[model samples]
Target: MFLSMSFRLRTEVEALNMVEAMGAYSRHRTVSLLKPRGDGKGYRLVIAPAVSGQAIAFGYMKSLVELAQQKNLPICDQCRNYESKGGFVKHGTDTSGDLENLVRSCIVEDVTGFMIAKAEVRRTSAIQFSYMTPDIDSSDVAIDPQFHVRAAKPGEKPQPFQVESGTAIYVLGVALDIDKIGVVPDSNGKPKIVVANRAERVKTAIQAIAHLLEGLSFGAKKARYLPVYDVVGAVAAISHPVPFMVSPARISKDMDYVTKTVLRASNYVKLFSDAKETIKLFYMDKENVVGEVKAENIDITKADNVSELVLKIIEVIEKSLRD
Candidate 1:
């Protein structure tokens, strides 16, 4: 007679070996972690993705402690020496606020049915869903050859600078233009972040710079503004609604694209502005404009609201007496 016998693994034995066999067992585990599935004696715990090791250990300890307490088992000795033994003690142990740590017991079941057979362990804080859109546009941006403000070395067609919709552009080197809201120049010379929305302010600052560049190019030196305006026209001509729609994941990508485009545009404008400033400084012998050009004086106070941002660009120009 040939007889095959199976040995049922004890809960204590399994707990003892959990740390040792984790690597080997994790490979076969399907990771279908769910709510605790058993009672005091025997229960199944489902492991979920993104669940940290600490959390799992806590879950395991909690169920085990509950079972021990039900059986009237003594946990004091283990609880007392936990700090030295590298074990955890649950809260309400001594009420010293040092017991937030969890206590878990090792448990295993055999194929044979036992009391409270096929029980389950319970847990909380499962997967979460996000309502707002993600901010990265994965398709529109690439990792290679970082976008540059200046043209790529000769023979390269300027790479398409695509951006996601709802992406905002900002002005570079224009932080200095912010009006201090009735404050004279402070000793430190650094702009403060009181009521102004820093990020939106950056965008407004860039617009100010753009208007400043326009005024510099057209007013003092006529030809300097022409090249840059032509560049702007070229960009606008090819401009197409970002190749894709907006989503949370794609928003970030689109933001980067838009940022790069805005930066490049601002840089081009700066190049022309700087060239004119230099030409005026050296050949024309003219002083730098002081919030000078009527167009460059962006009323940050007036642009404090949404209606101002959307409709006031035209109002700004129409209101200007020089134009």
Candidate 2:
């Protein structure tokens, strides 16, 4: 039930609030907010969640889409390129349900890479940027759950290690992996389980959630909550700093509905930013560069499997880190 609500709220009311909240989140997080693209048909809000930018972006966008739908606002078009029309946009030409025609228009535009970047381009929305470091005093750092310990055991089902050390330790150079699985043995010899990706899935999830967290914080004007696992992910630590980016856009046709759009956008950003930030603060080094992205052009046709490609990227990152 809680899970359902989480997903629903994220896709509805919370989404509307994102537009109004963007400036505050950016200012407080101490991260960077890239210039919003206002050129072409719509606006492009891009963000880089040093920790989980991608997941964060997804969460924010998903929620915003729902909110706009409920309010009779133009549905948001998820485009791979800000300047390209790969998604749909609404035009007043259709007599279908106001939202329905809007959706159709968007679909048509998306196919051609011509989207209304901003619903009303005459007005410009202002966004803020913020970045904050953990209260660590040293260059070398490691972050573990205040309650998590033990290298993940191998298997389909995994159990948390009896943490001999009560406090989660922070370490540098250990990378977080999301969507990974680990198994522990039961008394009968059956392995209990925990699963995520080996490494890439972990990173992708991490980036996704981090951007969400930052968005939430920027909007709520207070600390936001997230699942603890998201904070740690598969990465145990980093020796470099990763850049985080947050960008919010209305999923609606007019972009006039700031409440739902902003809310959803902020939530998504905060989810990703918090997890990413926590990992960076708890585990990564000052020198390590964290990568945050507000927007990217995703070519679904170009990849055989989006999920597989993401994981493969993880393999590459892992290999690079190990070297």
The candidate that wins on TM-score is: 2
Q: Give TM-scores for every candidate, taking all chains together and pairing residue i with residue i.
A: 0.16, 0.20
Each model's backbone clash number: 29, 133
Candidate 1 lDDT over 1-323, as tens digits, reads 00000100001001110122322122111133223223535544533112123433333333333443554433445433444756543222332321111111211110000122122211121111111111121211111211223357788765443211111111111112113211122248563333222233222322332333333211111221121221111001011111111111111312432223334433343555634321000000011111211122111212222223323432332233123
Please estimate how well model 2 matches the true structure, expressed as its whole-model Cα lDDT.
0.26
lDDT of each: 0.23, 0.26
lDDT of model 2 at residue 2? 5
Question: In candidate 2, which residue ranges exceed 4 Å CA deviation?
Answer: 1-50, 76-104, 107-142, 146-158, 161-323
TM-score of 1: 0.16
Cα RMSD to the true fold for all candidates = 31.0, 26.2
